[model samples]
Target: MSIAKRPNPLFRNLNAKIAALPMIATTLVVFLGCSIWTVIYSFSKSRALPVNEFVGFAQYERLFRTSRWLISLENIVIYGVLSLLISFVIGFILAALIDQKIRFEDTFRTIYLYPFALSFIVTGIVWQWILNPSLGIQETVRSWGFENFTFDLIANRGTVLYALLIAGIWQGTGFVMVLMLAGIRGVDREIWNAARIDGIPVWKTYLFVIVPMMRGVMVTTLVIVAAGIVKLYDLVVAMTQGGPGIASEVPAKYVYDFMFARANVGQALAASTVMLTTVLIILIPWVYLEYGKKKAQR
Candidate 1:
């Protein structure tokens, strides 16, 4: 007969806890603390800087009513949706095709991923030149033979966002492909063999089995691409300068303009709060579902 000894939870993994203290403190102080501060200031009528006087939701009201802010919201939503869908489809397709173990695989992969190494500013500038009416694709095609070639998507206000979309896809698809490829490769060899034994077509197997199994990877890629879309300022600035009359304005640019240019910290914080809410809306559910499932399984 022996007394059962219970382990103290607080002392468990003490070394790991000590190692993580710096990061935890940084996250709490830098990220969480600043977020709360921003939210508090958002409700205040801060003109040049943060102040204590509460203004209710006047900043929010003005933010919503502003035409530029509204346009920015609409643009980001459209860009985010289109970019996510297109990147996912194109990336998965490329990954699947490459997974067939073709020759020159390394070469093709390097070629695809090379663009991803370039910064968004560089990508935007390069694409800006390529889409130029006189010096880019249009000029090259016209020089060859087609005198009526007009491949200038960047110039037209109606199609400028699409131009940005093209540049974004070119820059990001490689990384997405790499992620999807890793996920696809990670599927057990036994699973593939079993699917084959069951006489499942390759496309069917991929569509039904592999895609469903790779949900986690897909979600990760979605969050990355969605975050990029939400913070779409530098690209627009470098390429279009929100040109053709604010045709490609985005929320990030709106925040910057309000904060620095207009000197309206409250309005900027209000806009910032909206962006933060948008991100949290997408993030919270994913985290809940993912971790909840893992914890339940454990």
Candidate 2:
């Protein structure tokens, strides 16, 4: 009698799966595993290092009550909202304007996008010098017989965040512009022809038809920019160092300070968990609507 053959259990792309095993293992062990550990330790009373003393929400209570943490929360909210709105608008506008077949298109695109090649630290330092009251914009303007010019927002408590906002936009909007331009280019030429045939104005076409069709690109951009806003630390450190008396503090900086400077690992982990939860809350619905439904449909 002939023996029955054993069937292969793995997927057809066995080689590809094997190749990805290292990365898969890394993701599970490093990212997911560390995240779970951090969340667990956030409830502890650890100091100097992670421990298991079990604090029972006491760390979180102190976190919320702390003035620095509260200020950081408020600053991040303001920064996130304003940065998203301004960057989206400016980027889309730049992309659209460049799409008009303007002269030296490549040159203009290079200039617009070059800033994105620089790191946030570099951008922050450069802008810090440019915005410095004694040696930068204000000084130059004053020398130009405009001594009454008082453009010292970076040094002022009430307006330091906006100064950070300006530097952020200058550095990031270029990348957004490039993304928006790609999305705009991906639009069907047939749609534009039809819009023109119907005597629709170019502005109206973009505002009504083009933008709505680029929903995927817009959502992707929003997610990326929002993530950067949430994890804002380097730029603030390089530029303001959360200065002007904690006016420009942000959550990521707070976590860093607590973890390293103060040696309060438990409190740092707690604050980090809060930040992670905030991000998940914003992302989960979007991910479900965007990708989950498609998987279900498939």
Candidate 3:
């Protein structure tokens, strides 16, 4: 008698695969297809609409030479770098504080995390009001006897990006704190006890022992924050409107204006392609290294 043959691997999950075909196809068509189209058209010179005739890197050359684009890049770099450093440091501190099992722990966490629940638009609007020189902090302070005090960070081009940075950090730190708290809680209890037995300071325990174990969670948080930084559009729109002379403009805003308002499709797509390339450059190596390590471990 012949033995029964094994089922084909491709057919093992055939039903599930069939059910997922629509989603897979949608992603391939809607996202991947559009992205490929954008990249291809970026090489062509176009206005008011995309032109099929290729002009090579002319769009990219103009994009780099544009003063507004250069200013936007500088603003994003400063905002991104500071946001990364400040959020990580403050989030870790807040998480460590909460992990001490302080009284009213739940209340404290809720208060700290409340801001994160608000959308970026709301956050930017709220901060814009608070930073308004004539009506907000400066007015309030002047009324209270500091008449000569000036707080116009949002109006001045030099300090406007930092104003955005402050709002960004305020709205984001709570989420970062929660992620860090989860990582802290996931650390082994035995390790905490061991540190205590060795008479290690609380801060030392966190700095040396607990943090090293939370590397995975930290990496995940960093990736999320970096992605948000790359797409810095809504908050800038809601708050500054790329004002103070486009000092607060970011890449996403640049792409939006070029595509819709200016109708320069070629330059718009070129900027988008550059943004996509930057993201892939950052993420591909991270994915390879992280997953490669996991596969080796297994």
* Candidate number of the best lDDT: 2
lDDT of 2 by residue, 213-294 (tens): 9999999898888987899999999999999989999999999999999999988999999999989987887888888869
> lDDT of model 1 at residue 216?
86
TM-score per candidate, in order? 0.92, 0.94, 0.94
Model 3 TM-score, 2 decimals: 0.94
Candidate 2 local accuracy as lDDT? 0.93
Q: What is the C-alpha RMSD of each candidate to the true structure, in Å?
A: 3.9, 2.2, 2.6
Give a tens-digit lDDT track for model 1, residues 19-133. 9999999899989999999999999999998899998999999999998899899989999899989989999999999999899999999999999999989999999999998
Clashing pairs in 2: none
For candidate 1, report its TM-score: 0.92
